[model samples]
Target: MTIRAAHFTPEVLLEAPRRSEATPNSKGSLALFSVSTYSFSEHKRQSELRVLDISRNESKLVTDSEDASNPKFLDDNLITVLESKDGATNVLIGDVNDFKKTNYTAGTIDGSVDDWKIKDVGKGKYLIAIAASTQPDGTLYNSEKAKKPVTTGRIYNSTFVRHWDTWVTANKNSIWVGTLSKDSKTSKFALGHFENKLKDSGLESPIPPFGGAGDFDITDTNLAFVAKDPKLNPAFNTKQNLYVIKLDNGSSPKKIDIPGFEGATSNPNFSPDGKKLAFLSMVQNGYEADKNQIFLLDVEQSDPPKGLFTTPDNKGTWDRSPSSITWSNDQKNLYVTAEENARVKLFSIPLAANSTNSSFPKAVFDEGSVASTTFLDSGLFISSSSLIDNSAYHLVPSSGAPKLLSSSSRSGSSFGLSRSQVSEIHFPGAKPGTTIQAWLIKPSFFDDSKKYPLAYLVHGGPQGAWEDSWSTRWNPAVFAEQGYVVVTPNPTGSTGFGQELTDAIGGEWGGLPYQDLVNGFDYVEKNLSYVDTDRAVALGASYGGYMMNWIQGNDLGRKFKALVTHDGVFSIPGQLGTEEIYFPNREFGGPFWENKDAWNKWDPAQKTENWATPHLIIHSEKDFRLTIAEGLAAFNVLQEKGVESQFLTFPDENHWVLKPENSLLWHTVVLDFINRKVGLKAYSEQSETAKALKESALSG
Candidate 1:
């Protein structure tokens, strides 16, 4: 709750979680999340969530240092996560690569609960957990802790309890449910929830989950669930219960319905010497289209309850549903993760118990439109955004270069896909022949005998595309760790060079992407001879703040210097009444009273008194899309027409910035306003001009 400001202000990025979050520590069908080496664009909402072992993949800051999500294993010698020292949350455990921690418990709880389930029973002598406690209809619930709990309850509510997943359990007193989240919050992906384990703490549904399955996944045998209570999907109401909850230790707990199995179930798994159980049902007779099918069922052949199961028929296809299903620790490789062709892939299926119509096909990894994955022997994990450099990798396969994992390396794109050693310029257009591709990053610490200090940057969906997400409150790694080189250009209405270079920057905002961002500063000063064509600096945010208001009224570049701008909108009809989702009534596909010469030739208030340059801007009134009244009317017309400019604005924070200590106070307010207007610095190398932007710059 403390925010400060000095020079050209707008700083507040402190909320450190930076990459390596892999997440899942509990729940079932194998789950654990910490693969991160740090990528960014906040893991496209935790993509496909698969890679279960890379932190103690054994030891190397595995757990105990603290901060873990839902990490569980138990049978492989225990892991369990969820810690917090003084703030008080509990369930800690150790040794799986959580090197050490014993068992502790106390409580304060009130974070967003993930999932965890154990119930081992026999030998470790039966363990038990279920998760999400706080019941009585609100704070959240689904309890059952075994030795010291007995059974606690609370089904759903608290802005829809993080989706819901317990999967399968059988000890701390019975459990199973589904849909494990598919995007920020979709709520009960499929269906199944039937509880009753009460000793006086919580839980009492007798087949609830909005009365069915919610999203579905029931294969339990702790005494119920062979399959029937299922119903929901009026396009996702999600209720379709499939019974079989028999656990009656001392009374009441029954629901064994299985008539021709009525559909739903998912990724069930067992067959590794546990006697066949394999699952994935779906079916749906055009009934809102669903196809899944892979089923097996042998559960030790006790044929009595109307025994009869065999459908046998499938190659594979799913316009949607069947996003995951694994099993191959000797179960003969099954692996699924499907959504096929239109995004989300990875197939490989082979068990041949009789071989239906065919089963020999193995595709395994796709992510075409990016998002739908898991085939990891160690490299097909997917949670994407580098739509190709717009940044966020973590791919792994041969491990050559895929772990950008994201904490805020932020890219997979507000620009292009991800991957950038940096290079590509090609330009000719407006006559005879045209090519233009323009790209650059050169400063992971570039050093051709050392020169540095550049900073072009520019990307704000002016149709957005720099082939990677370019960061800027001065970030290209805080101007390469306080030195500066940046350069990101995909100009001429960017969008990976497709669809007419993004409908030529829809509404032709600021002419030819403002000459492809001033011809990417003359193609990084004629192919980066080490940069410094005399202290360059232009930066951007939101249509690159309308090309820094069209580069101080078209003088473009003499290699002058300094200029920042975030939340920079300047005034498209005063930014259509402070934006949010309806983006200036469609970001400028029209409006401002139906196009006033494309809003006076893509207006920056038709050139703010020809901008004079030494700019800074950086706003935030929690800008959901673009607002801060166009950087407070260019800081009240650069402090009522004297010009030199400075604005800052941030504090109840927004418009991106989940906090990493306000991203190191937004790189110390754009490197202390480019070290007093384009002097560029941090250490400032005894300013001979900041010793050539600090020895070829680059450090992060």
Candidate 2:
């Protein structure tokens, strides 16, 4: 059964890093970044929010709020921010020095705040707001208490929680935020345009098909604005489209339609003079339109979006999606980065007046790593650990390729035994000759003489790599901090190596590659003296879930103590026709009706009778990929056979929990479950864990 790439549980695609930050200041300068761990429990990506000094590579800790987000760097002293803990939102103003220490809570008057923002009316006066949690219509507000609040962005403290409309930026008083759009399930529009207005939980909010239907940004001609709608239902791509809105005072939005590009447009930036807008689009998907482009949109013309270079020139019609496009001071060229091979490949576009699409985009430099592009004055900024320096960068004008910038890295910080660090351990991989380079993070203050318990980490992406990234939710740090020896092996079919390694599992489901993972675990036991072979658990999401199913079907062993699958696929056949996304269809190349055996053998459902692992299934309600039913099917099978298992589904989260509060809460539950099942003392519930949570709240 062919599955659309989107439907493959998304664990692999998710492994690739995602980035977000406020717009650059007047001089195109942003030397510092306020980052937080905004991620879901289902994937293995970096998670944490902190103010990183771009120049020094230093960081100031923010509250451990899963929803710690909406940061505006107004000057250097003051910053406007939104913090949500429980179900309310709190907007605050602070000098950069004491921003972390400021009192933050939801609501404007008192008690918990519901919503907020910082508005500067261009002059000198600044306006801050605290709105009611309930929308105008009277339904519950978009918070923890709502029906299902999607953990949209930031890691607000554990108590803070917001719905899909978690973050937004606009001109202080006018409230014209050209970049963000707040849409609800009932077709409600918070940022002017909404297609499907979802029911509001708090008061009453306006339904979509909102006030600004086609475009926004109606005030400055110099500023180019375009809003792309990913459709009322993001899980399905067919409903999505792109729109370009020119921000001129009193000018209505222009819904420019690109003839061939079907998917949504992402991260559109403009030239210094605002004469041109550069953006990227996924174009078409099912067949072979993985290439994204750095299209040049003429703000002077009508629907004049020009497709530049199709990336990887050799691969089908691949496109290098230019993300975070920025113009250099000289205006002689544009500094941008394109995403390639799951990581970002940096590039440059010249502003030569006489050059065509072929001449302007001259290849200059590429890190060939998973880095998110940003800018800091003359140089470009990137957020990635893939580089040798962990947090290094490139200085555009003076650089050759890209230099590692991080001078000092606080490599030693633990959340107790719940989060640990294990470096430089190698294991045997799928085949005997292949070496599985890995890391085994153990509990803090671990007793080496004694054999400690071990929790196996199954990375989600079949093509994804197991890299070192930080997170408080389902964090490897948690296991090490909590005292368990967590094993993460980059078995065969993992990325970071190349596409050959990634495509290894493309057509093979329950074949040798899957066995390679099991073998990798065995290799760890046989090689690493630090790992306790006796205690182990099979854990993963997406395709990793597929492996877990394979293990259960084969009745591998009683060696595994517990199993966890987050947004995984249980039945390939069922997933093809049923999933919200068409990923299975695309991957497998056809419907299950045409290829029955391939569907059966490739599916973990067929081997249900041989299941044995004590499994835990986590399903994100907003996950557009492998629907919740797939997880439920696994639960039913495990339960019917009397196999020990539990299922926890987050009704308010998406494929990934992009909020801090929920992330903290999520990590808490997962760690607690693992600790309890693994025969570890539940001391964390009373001491270490509680203290960590509290500290995160106070600091974050």
Candidate 3:
């Protein structure tokens, strides 16, 4: 059979619009968002600040800066913008009238700003909480310095000499308070003494490699931030405790003592009255992915923070982790966006006395995943997106339904490429009485009369779910555009389901979760007449990559014509030795020496003897989570077995292919490998546009 190649091009796949930093004003009448436009030819990203009127459902340009972010409403008449250009970052305050008029010029705050918050400290004085990175001696760490070493020679004293994508530096993040004068004649802003030193004598806040603005909260008199105690080993310990730094006396930050939450605490949000602090805490230490429980700290009380759900009098329960929390106007309720099943929904928890409702976190909105929520007098303004849509602002009234307030240029209606039609499929679970949900995305130009191949995409985290949300990487639409049906399933271990479901795969990585995937495929093949089962391909990254490797070594190898694994785990033991050891130990039930059999049972390297599927391996040299060695070992095994296989490595990339040029190449290579393996014409022969894009990406 002479198979024809698909007509989709790399440019079409790489040109999707990006949106981030969606923030709503205090009144909730206005919302600001950053929209990024990527140019593959130029290999650069240009971002603009756009403000939306929630009441009018209209949006207007706010800034012309290509790198504007963290747009926050400082007051009714002013907003703050974090502008980054030429390696320098600064905070700019823009007039609301000027922003509405599309005038980009604004007053600048002299400093490299990472995060900032404005609080009225009384008597015409304003306190600004600024989180910026600086050298040990209180000097700004510029981009040039970050690119070059502090010293001409290389020296290391700590284990984190390098992290996920960047080398470690002595420059540490700290909270600095600045005073803003209210008098119009002398309107001045001056940086004051550092309120909290994130890194002091080898101690740091928010923890390295991940934490940021979400790790801290500010009040008129006090500031609370998350940090690991210096006494503990920074390399292995993940316990992050909340510490409060008093602004009045500038005392040393004191760690709040939480009885059972030894794991990690983050996202500190202070109530309107400033008497209570709400944060997210994990019960088990070292297990980063452990369920995050909401905790409330009464500042007046000296005792530890109380777990909202684990209180002795109230057995309040929430199955999912709460994120991006905000206090209600009256400070009687806390609103948060949390994952439930395949969608991230808004949930509210009441913080009133004598409220014993266990199911207090009532769902406020149901459609699409809410990334963030801001409460205003009018209603709740949200930045939301789904599998078929990009992020946009939506305002949900307290008494009425949600209304679209802002429109994204990259929405399904405006997307240049053929958009995919997404639908959820439910099938009997691999376990008793359990139901699994899988998303089926069909090409917009789908013709049921002609069969189409299936691109079965698996998610990472093993604990992570393939949520109904937009993704720049491993997008289902990219596959659908190639005339293939994309199937994304939430197996046994996937989150957003429940703690029971999420914890099930901890020690049984390849057990029920693998079966759930297999069952999902079986259900689709039996029910969907348009699916070309014979031409199917399986692909995944990280934990999903581990599953891809597992598939090749099991009976499932015969089901798919080809397989692709990116940064997958080839050997559990190897990963334990190379990657972060604590997580592996916790997830796999102890160290390799103690649980040799448990580690060996699911080791993909051990089952290589049964492998026969054609494989494509993709890995990055800097992928610390799953080292490049895992990919190399899998590719080596494939070659030794005389299997048709290819390997692609990215030297500058980390666990995920993030660079625009590299991401374009990744899509091209993976698509080309699948085409060639499925008996279709090669990607080079399919479209000249694809060939040119690939060549340009490779050469540049």
Predicted structure with the largest lDDT when compared to the true one = 3
What clash pairs does model 3 have? none
Clashes of each: 84, 109, 0
Q: What is the C-alpha RMSD of each candidate to the true structure, in Å?
A: 25.1, 11.9, 4.2
lDDT of 3 by residue, 1-700 (tens): 0122233345554565577747776767666777676776676777778777766766677886666777777676577677776556555666755754532433344346677777777765667777777777765566654555466666886565556666676777777666655555655333343444443535565456777777777788788888776676645666888888776774777888777677777889988778888898877777777778888887777877777777552223666777668888787778988889888999877776754244468888877788877778887878887776666677778787888776563455555333348888998877898899988898877888989888899999887888877777877877887778899999988888887888888888888988998899899889999998899999999999999999999988899999999999999889654435677787788878999998888989889999999999999998887788899999999999999998888899999998777877788789898977666556656656557766765532
TM-score of each: 0.26, 0.61, 0.91
Per-residue accuracy of model 2 over 306-411 as CA lDDT, tens digit each: 6665444323232344545656655566766654433455566766675435454544555434345545555655445431122344444446456544422212
lDDT, candidate 1, 450-497, per-residue tens: 887777777675654554322323335445434556666666555434
Model 3 clash count equals 0
Task: Give the best candidate by TM-score.
Answer: 3
Estimate every model's Cα lDDT from 0 to 1.
0.46, 0.51, 0.76
Sort the predicted structures by lDDT, highest score first.
3, 2, 1
